[model samples]
Target: MNSPDVSALEITSSQACRVALRGPELIIEAANKAFVRSAGRDGFLGLPGWEAFPELRGQGYLELLDQVYRTKKPFVGLKMPILFQPSKGAPMEEHVTDFIYRPIEDGSGHVTGVFIESYDRTEWARA
Candidate 1:
């Protein structure tokens, strides 16, 4: 059987708001345009997840990421409420979203990173 094309997967992921984080610190490794816009900050690329969104520090997201990294498990969240700033110095806005945090493993079967994908559903939720 022929293997599926990896590029196709990359292409599909690129269309969504997605980010890849590496190491236990969850340093930002890569992100798509949508993810960058969603973050609403500059200079987040290379920063730890906590540093990237300081406002999210107490929101349990870091703990969730830690659990996923430790257990090599994936987390799926549906219609979750999130508050974030649209830009620096902007007031926080509430958004409902669906998201996934998938563990990334190396050939040795050790978890190495996390792949996060999110879909905004605020309008749908408000309608």
Candidate 2:
């Protein structure tokens, strides 16, 4: 496996609160610091989204992502509920977030991947 570019990850980390890139086959190609903070672990690069976060499978997110990928359309979720283990070997916690899954296209306009940009809204939802 190739190493993730530290400088690129650092740049992405600085640009967004939660950012990730999912390449073909839904493998996670990149993730930012905030994403790691939310996931409670790192090393997700090259894993399928569902495999990386098994808790999301039955929660409709997997299907949603598949739909977005197959249709090559963007999806926006407001206050989407996600369950994630804060730490490896820790209990899972539910978080509310606003997210967008935008289709990334290549030069020929074919969708090559999905770019995820998100903001945690758990606190706001509890208010």
Q: Each candidate's TM vs. the true structure? A: 0.88, 0.84
Q: What is the model-wide C-alpha lDDT for candidate 1?
A: 0.80
Mark the regions of model 1 whose C-alpha exceeds 4 Å error after superposition: 1-13
Candidate 1 lDDT over residue span 2-40, tens digit each: 212223256245657887888999998778778777777
lDDT (Cα, 0-100) at 79 in candidate 1: 91
lDDT accuracy of residue 11 in candidate 1: 28
The TM-score between candidate 2 and the true structure equals: 0.84
Lowest lDDT 10-mer window, candidate 1? 1-10
- Candidates' C-alpha lDDT: 0.80, 0.74
Per-residue lDDT of candidate 2, residues 1-127 (tens digit)? 2223234555374545544455667888778777777788887888898888887778887787777777887899999888877887898899898988777666566666677778889999999
